[model samples]
Target: MNHFKQTVALKDVKCFALHGYYPEEQLTGNHFIVDLETEFSPIGFDDELGQTVNYEDLNSIILEEMKITQKLLETVLKNIISKVIRLYPFVEKIDVSIKKLNPPMPGQIGHSFVKLTYTPTN
Candidate 1:
């Protein structure tokens, strides 16, 4: 049997966090935007909740990671990817992008982001 993959994109997830390289950044939190895409085998296409990935669970994981982990966006992104792969074993690949709005850059108003892609090993 041949297995097909499905891609799901969760974009523009607004979060408030204090993840940065500078010391003062830790004290001052800023807005963040997260976009995630998870690729997995399609088990079913029914409209029922159980037929597909539970976004509620996914969102919870993302929120929990953002709240507890106060480090670089890269670390946070990697953490999220690890958690997702663990929780959803059927997932084959994933792409995560995290953006910081109103950052403490020299002249830019705000906007620092990172993107990561991962493929789990069998």
Candidate 2:
């Protein structure tokens, strides 16, 4: 029997965090939006929580990681992926994107975003 994969997504998670290269940006903090997607193989169809990843847990993970200050969005994405993989080992693939709202720049600009996709070898 072939087991089908399931996907769980959490999008537009709003957060206020101190993450930036500029010292003033870090001190003032900024609005951020996070999106996460996870793909995993289900063990069964018995309507059990253990069979799939919980979106609430994913939200919590994002919120928790956002609290820790980081200079780069790449670091933030990596941290989130690591935590997710650790908590849900069954997750084979993870896609994460983080957007920094109203970034500090010379000209008027919108948010800047970084996306990362991770696939565990094991």
Candidate 3:
């Protein structure tokens, strides 16, 4: 029997962080939503924690990265992806998206976001 690929996802993870180009934006902080998906080789029918990526670990990484101040969402996304890759070297692919809520702008703009997909080269 052929086993399909496996994926673990952490979706709609909410966070409040101070990340922006402007100093005031960092000082004041803002709301953010994070979404992540990680794909790895299939782990057959074994029900073991070590067999699959842990969602809690992913959440912790997201929260930890969010606390750091960065001028660009792209930077934050990269940082998160790098950390995850470091922890799970077996990870084959990663998809991440970060949304900044209620951005400071003259006109009405709900949010701005950065989304990235990464595949490790071996």
TM-score (C-alpha, index-matched) for candidate 2:
0.94
Give the alpha carbon lDDT tens digit for every residue of 10-37 in model 3: 9999999999999999999999999999
TM-score of each: 0.87, 0.94, 0.94
Q: Predictions ranked by TM-score, top down?
A: 3, 2, 1
C-alpha lDDT values of all predictions: 0.83, 0.93, 0.93
Model 1 steric clash pairs: none
Alpha-carbon runs more than 4 Å astray in model 1: 1-3
* Deviation from native of the Cα of residue 15 in model 1, angstroms: 0.7
TM-score of 3: 0.94
Weakest ten-residue segment in model 3 by summed lDDT:
42-51
TM-score, structure 1 vs. true: 0.87
lDDT of 2 by residue, 36-86 (tens): 999987777899988889999999999999999999999999999999999
User: How does model 2 fare in lDDT?
Assistant: 0.93
